[model samples]
Target: MRESQPRESGAQAILEKYDRESQFRLNLGKWGLIVTFLGVYLTVFHLYTGYFGVLPSQKQGAIHLGTALGLIFLLFPAKKGMQKHQKTVPWYDIILAFLAMYISYHKVIFLDSILQSRITGYHPFDMILSIVGILLVLEATRRTVGLPIVIVAGITILYTIFGKYIPTQLLSHPGFSIDRIATNLWYQESGVFGTPIQISSKFIFLFLFFGVMLVHTRIGAFFNDLAFSLTGRYTGGTAKAAVSASALQGMVSGSSVGNTVASGSFTIPMMKKAGFKPEFAAATEASASTGGQIMPPLMGAAAFIMMEYLGVDFSTIMLAALVPAMLYFTGIFIGTHFEAKKRGIVGLPKEALPNFKKLMLRNGYMLLPLIVIVGTIMIGFTPQRAAIIGIVSAYLISLIRKESRLSLKQTIYVLEEGARVALPVIAAVATAGIIAGVVSITGLGAKFATGIIALSGGILPFALMLTMVACIILGMGLPTTANYVVTATVAAPALINTFGLEPIAVHMFVFYFGIVADITPPVCLAAYAGAGIAKANPFRTGLNAVKLAIAAFIIPYIFIYDPILLLVDVTIPHFVLAVVTAFLGMLAVSSAMIGFFVSNSRIWERVLLMLGGLLMIHPEVYSNVAGFLLMAIVWLLQRNRKNGEVSQSAAV
Candidate 1:
């Protein structure tokens, strides 16, 4: 579990290069003290609100946005090269930071009077502030989150201003007056303070704090140790262990690239040492780490957003996500097993693996924090309450062992880290809220949905395909939070309205593709980060990641068609059948993708495995029967071929 300082530094450097969220000022000297105090204050503010009570929606959001904006401007440089090594905050950034805070506080101070007046028009003062506020948000977003979302928001604003001039009926609307636009985008809950930021401020921040506490308590190491113990002696054990550990870490870890660098720094080297190709080693970790965003408990903080968008309870969304997540990891695990078999790679030495029984017994208490979070939510506590308890439980549990315990200084640092980590999310969601606000005022969601249906010729499968592409493309550039918000805002409506699908299914479908975008080609940040660690080709790693994570691409389509795979309104027998068959389906598909099964598959066999896998996964009795028969046929043929080869060798 111990890593050299240089390895940790290498991982940090990689994280900073690819993951914008990790690229922040180190707060040298006096600036360090200032950043530290601000970080602690941010965390404490959220914890205090969660424990006592939150302010009104607008006020709470204003505080959250204001604090986050200030921190982001101070912590992240205007340009990557402008603040090399994060030496100090520039004077201009300091002024911009204060301006951003003033913009947010403008809402908090005048909210009562504005609501009391119930005026539809913007005052001159509010109007100017609104314009400045929007600009400040975009600037902070560019500093912390990147430009894709900022561009999207800018387009929405421009559309709002000029929509009346558009010749196309479907795409155009009567543009709002500048006054109305300013009021709606700033003063109302629909814009910067909309559901996205509401959820971010209220729920996401607490869960993020819980994740930080988990790291402080060394639970990440525990997960790695536990995974190595369970899988390190099996075939392609190191790679499999990476899958297991990354999933565990990704549950709370959230950022696919971040998780990749964190665990890949440990697992990728071992995988290379174990004789797996560098690309495959990196791909395995990248694919597995990406799946963590879809896993339950936290789900990269997407579950809360889904809860709001779907208007469903937290448990429903979390439960629905389970089977698909399992199938995703299964695909990766099976692919790794076959790859190891094909390469004739053996497992790690048993003596080198940790003893599963003893390790669990010693550190079993570490799991209670997660258990506390899930258990409380299931038992009817709010997510905010559950997260607060989870954070406290992590600290309490850490005190059980001297090595796991955090000192007062470390505890404060954990708080600081929690707040610092949340800055990018805050910026992304608030900017995305502007996009969502535009969609609302312009009635673009409905129009966009209609356009999608018309474009797809009213075919559900075709619409799903279109939506999938949109999600991945948007995901490539957006942070997970912003990606989900944008896709769920625009793309999800297409599927939900056109097909009358389960809202959860529609949302989960978009959610899955968004997370996998991290591994999709051309701009696959997660794969790029993994390749950096493994010293492999980034594009090849992305292709391998897409291959290894084939189930993620396939599962969304299946769930949309079957809904059984998503565990919506299914009987016990049917649910069990769906899961088992789906698992078998993954086996076939994974083997086909890897070009290996039971002693290496022939090309035609690979084709059949794929066809049969898809058929079996369809959840129809007839298809399952035919698919199973095909899989059996291939299994028997491969087995016979292997035996014949052995006999021929013996005769020779």
Candidate 2:
């Protein structure tokens, strides 16, 4: 076997550089032990609550956020580039850490009193804690989630406190007093302890915990092996396998950058060795990994929040996501396929490929946890209940192989790792709650929606384009949960209220764009992470990722114009017809984007193919027919030219 040290160290460096959550102090001996204990305790607490009954919303959110705040202060440095040399927690961070705990838990300690004082209002001390608590949350958020979300939240708070002085009548609010803002944001369930955190505390954490458990079982390896077993011997097989593996791993890995580095570390090297260009290799992985957020079941922990926002069950969200998710992957898959063919990149030799049947026979049980979670949820268990069963199932399944089995110490480590992995998400959700709280309090969501509609001059397509832009901008800096929260709050309403679109469609629209931000140009972190592994240019990798995942950009509009693509109120015939046409549309578009279809496509052929794809994807009978005709014309021309060449070669 290859010496794993180089790859391991390289991936670690890339992760630390790209993913802030991975940048943390380590090996501080006693401090590390304390951090471990806190992490384990945090996971166990959630596991206990998930199995038994959860605490009241305020109490649950408080404990969860409090523990996370403490962890964040200890594990993450206030500044970047300090993790490598830091030996001990600073005195100030230690103070801030403890204060974070106390301020966050003050609500849990005085729940009854706080409730009693709802009408009478908060005491001076209570208000002081509220003020400090908000600041601490913001600071911890800054440390773990990066400063953009903090800036956004900070701006929102400023708006909340000073909106009355705004010059514009449309955007202005009556404004709020400090006490009111503090109480609403801190003490009340509407702010730091609001729906976003509540879901994070309740559903997302366990799913994250479950994901961590899978990590310990080496399910990631299984996923990679499974993908390779299926796709490794086909044209451009390695790249296809990367997409397949990343999609599977990305759902559980929770972050696009994390997934890209984890899978790309292995896949990118293979692609480069297999004759693919470094930029294309990195782009393929980045695009595929980024799509993982749109994949069903976890959807990067956004599905649970969507359930709450759309007032639908987990199953509905899953079903709604299924088609678009598939289309997104299909786009990337086709891109890889075409690139491989274009470059004459063959699959790995058949002798080197794993046996699919044997691979599944040995490790197929690893899939049970995901199946169990989905099955239980569909059968009426709460997401928490389903996740608990999933975690337990994952543990039990891991024991089937002695190699995968966790010793007591390792199991404890898994718990600790689960909490540690969840810190960024916890901070993000809590901070997102601050943003959501402001929106709800100031009626900003409605106004923002109205503004978008007005700005688009009431054109649905234009409004969608604007909403997509907003989602991408917000998503560039926000975590998945935060991105969804903000967009769903401010942007979703824009499409829904004006266009009277299905709620799920509008929400999915924002959800899709928010996720693609990780691969979109400028600040596409997932692509950058992939580029890091592939030793390619980050900006070029990002551009390639955008090209490869172009369907992601187009699919949202397709669904928005035709909700049938989302499986919203669809009939069998229509659903099948929609899927078929969409796939065809994607194929033509993918070929056009790649400049290859049947053969090396001419520029005019690519243009016609692109136009044909858009029309076919539009979901009208006339356009579908027209698109088919145009695509058919290109196919014939390319085929005739290729056949003529073949005949000429044969004669020679």
RMSD of every candidate to native, in Å, equals 2.3, 2.3
Among these predictions, the greatest lDDT belongs to: 2
lDDT by residue (503-552, candidate 1, tens digit) is 88888888888888999999899999999999999999999999999999
Model 1: residues with Cα > 4 Å off, grouped in runs? 1-7, 117-120
Residue-wise lDDT of candidate 2 within 307-343, one digit each (tens)?
9998888888888888998998999999999989889
State the lDDT at 509 in candidate 1. Answer: 85
Q: Per-residue lDDT for 454 in model 1?
A: 89
C-alpha TM-score for every candidate: 0.97, 0.98
